[model samples]
Target: MRSSVPGTAKKFPLHPGHPERICWGCDKYCPASDMACGNGSSRTQHPAEIFGDDWFEPDPGADDAGAGREG
Candidate 1:
């Protein structure tokens, strides 16, 4: 199924070659200098920048099986 909102269905790159050159704030993928969202003065940094190269990888310590479940 496709997303109802525009640009929301686009596949985001897990490891963009130049993450800093583009704005990760929205699906527009606008250049860092030109943010289409107009929500902030500065461009949002890609997750890879703050979380490192393994940003998409699951955390080994996270207990996925127990998430949202009560004992």
Candidate 2:
């Protein structure tokens, strides 16, 4: 089951066209330069930035083809 944590349960886009403009640290989705949460850190990088464009895609070498499928 997915966690009920604040940011953890929020919906996030898989491939935002512009990931650099917003901070992903919190649900506020603050502007990169203006982090409202003040976590004492720079903007959190979107998954795409750290893992390339296919970050959410299933690994081709994985054996579990139905791992993330709903049905």
Q: Which candidate should be chosen as best, given TM-score against the real structure?
A: 1
Model 1, position 43, has a per-residue lDDT of 86
Q: Report the CA-based lDDT of candidate 1 relative to the real structure.
A: 0.84
Q: Flag regions of model 2 displaced more than 4 Å.
A: 1-8, 64-71
Per-residue lDDT tens digits for candidate 1, residues 1-71, read 35667766677789999999988887678899878888589888999999999989998868786788888
In model 1, the Cα lDDT at residue 10 comes to 73
lDDT (tens digit, per residue) of candidate 2 on 2-62: 4577547567888998999989887677889889999568999899999999999988878
Residue 3 lDDT in model 1? Answer: 61
Report how far off residue 39 is in candidate 2 (Å).
2.4
Question: Model 1, which residues run further than 4 Å from truth?
Answer: 1-8, 64-71
Residue 41 lDDT (model 1): 90
TM-score of each: 0.73, 0.69
